[model samples]
Target: MSLSLIDAENTLASPVCALAGRAALRLALTILWHPQAQRIGEQFIAAAGSGDIDVNRFAPLFGGLAGNAQALGHRRIARDALRLRRHRDHGVSLLPPQSRMRVELNGAMLAGAPVRCTPEQVDAGLVIGLGGVVLLCVHWMDRLPQASAIAAVHGVGSAAIRVRELIRQVAATDLPVLLLGEAGSGKELAAQAIHQASARCRGPMVTVNLATLSETQAVAELFGADTGALARVGGGTLFLDKIGTAPQAVQAQLLRVLKTGEYRPVGARADQAARARLIGASDHDLHDGSFNQSLLRRLEALVVRLPPLRERRCDIGVLALHFMQAWSTRTGSAPELPLAFISQLCNYDWPGNVRQLGKVVQRALSAAQAGQPLAFDALVPGVAERTARVRLGQLSGQAVLDALEANGWLIRNAALALGVSRPSMYKLIGKHPAIRQIGQIAPAEIAAALAAHGGDTGRCAAALRTPSEALRRYLRRQAAGKLL
Candidate 1:
């Protein structure tokens, strides 16, 4: 479908919009890197009343940087930026530092390299932000199909990055691919990505959910009497979702096609050549003798196992932000997400994986007021308590101490790292002899820590293993006493 035809109200939530936002951000960053970048910013600020660009066609993309610039009375800057984008190659090159960092991000994402940039670095402008990096990486990796078959799969963690690398590697070949993952773990997305990245991307993609087809219906639906999926997906991709659920007879037929590159229709006298590349996905372990082992062996030529959402908790923040933006586009009202609620999201054991988390985010938005914090407990009901209980059960006294030290004694941060609530972290600390509460800390110790850290409250808090706010309050009381 043409992104230009999509309603402006809904485009922000669409994959097209997400891609456009990335493009706009990259363009803005590039302009910032240009030697005449300051002039461009001034021009955008100067031209506050230039005629609007086609909001219907270019708005989703230009609207990101251009629209924002216009809102700030810089219509000329927006217009110039758009013009520059149309002829971006004119002498523009990213600075060496930014270019090297971008290259590192690409390698980390598509080659499974260990390179990473912390948020601090991104904020300091030492490198592009993670969102920008990921978008550029995907754009480079996917190589721009006329239209993407699916939304860009979003992940930043090592597991997700490895999966992206595998998809890129496997897409270069025509061998059958097997996707193994829990339900809603993005197997279908992976299949689509493979098809879009493959040589057969120009062709059609036909999907058959085997779980929905019975034995009697499988042959007719798949191999068709006149023209089945194989016939319809000529020189393209045929994705069989829930492959483990395929009937025994259908499994044999699929094996024949995979092995000999041919398949017979339900009642055809002769077999036909199968040209479509096959991609099979399943949540089941097919090695238990129930599934066709021979067929399994054939489909396993390239295996990609999608990790569950819980295993990649590091990606939860970015994923949540994506879902929230989608929600905002759909509803036209941006809801604020509190840090505690985000911690709650990371701590919860999402049994249903990424799909479940997305649904919960939508529900939370629906239930929250325009100005209120999104209540995690109201929507999820006991998730916080259950998560806290589970996390506390797993932690010993020494484990709590180790977590606190590892996080530089930031209770909230340490709590999040250990998948427990702040209160639970304090409770665990109370039970540990090695750990001391702010109240238990002597004034002399606090004074000594402050002196050692050159009177930096933050450093003193870390050194004393106490909360900064409490330390600040204690110092305030001491100052008052000296004044009296």
Candidate 2:
């Protein structure tokens, strides 16, 4: 029998009735096939029960189903239905509340909403009947192609705990917001999330890279220009990235629009309608005096600064695994990420930040595809291996001498050869035992290494990549007759 209940009329009917009906259907299927249907029903019950609600009343049916592995071919159909039912209602509710959605649309003036959470965000208890079906849709959506950028630096580790709270606050407000972070820090993604949660999500979210536009063009673009100028954007949002670089004239024009919902297009003499909200992002010189103070004041309506990757080291492994899996799928190659590779990534300074990290991972994936062993050489190349080979306890003068001799005495040429500057080279060489023993790895030897690396400091540093620094310090103590 088809189960139908009055959704709007019987407002007081509890969800328990729906649960009971689903349970009855499973029991009927179990009875028809005895042990076979019983096992399938049990699996369904267990999976469903794992979620928030109690589907345990079906346990008797499940227990009956457990032992019939044979003659159970017919049970597959029954089990499939049960699995579908359970999956739809599984876990936590992932989407923002309707009220929250409404607020985002009207209060915040957001553009369109794109689902951002993973399948894990779905809530099991809040959904029933059709809600369960929508949950499956969320799972399917998650499997679709997504943006290739890494998750925000803040999305990893302990930082994630704090960020979730921040996300709540940022999403709740409709104020003009500014995101500050180093380049490739995922500021744009965060802005999207905010827009998704805000009230204007149903509208269009237009993005313009203010950094790429000329001063005159930016003005015309931001505020609709005259007859010749681009028409003003209708009800929607405008995302201005690298607004710090927006020219002074553009800033003045932009300020006018923010102050009064009016803007003229480039080369246009007349102002036009302005209904779009503004979201600005800046990675450089945001705090410097060179940026227009008025523009800063306007954008700072609400400011959120994203932390760097080095500050959130604990998330490196998780992020690396995620990226590795993603790239593996992209390359159609099953490449496993070794724990050691992740560990090495954690120790680096990450000067280029997440962008550099993505490049490193992509290169590693490419190398693994070429049938090479997954090694640190693929990421940073040479350093981890050399460090492992040298086995230096502390960085010291003698250690420098060892590496210098290994490479031949070349100083000016050598320092330039390594990614390290001349000062760092001198510092490394002076701290080692070799400085006193052979008077250092001879500047010329260092110079030769630099030359060999083609003056690419990164490459040279990789060539001399050893944990000699630690061993050098210990050696110095021993040489000075200062025993602990």
Q: Model 2: per-residue lDDT, tens digit, 290-374?
A: 8778778988888777666655443444455556667867867656445345435644446566777778888877776677776
Q: lDDT of candidate 2 vs native?
A: 0.46
Among all candidates shown, the one with the greatest lDDT: 1
Q: Rate the local accuracy (lDDT) of all candidates.
A: 0.58, 0.46
Q: Which residue runs does candidate 2 get wrong by more than 4 Å?
A: 1-156, 224-233, 267-269, 329-333, 373-484
User: What TM-score does prediction 2 earn?
Assistant: 0.48
lDDT of 1 by residue, 212-278 (tens): 9899888888999566899899999999999999999999999999999999877889888999999
Cα lDDT of candidate 1 equals: 0.58
Which TM-score value belongs to model 1? Answer: 0.53
Please count the clashing residue pairs in each candidate, in the order shown.
3, 66
Locate the minimum summed-lDDT window of 10 residues in model 2: 133-142
**Which stretches of model 1 miss by more than 4 angstroms?**
1-151, 369-373, 385-484
Error of 2 at 74 (Å): 40
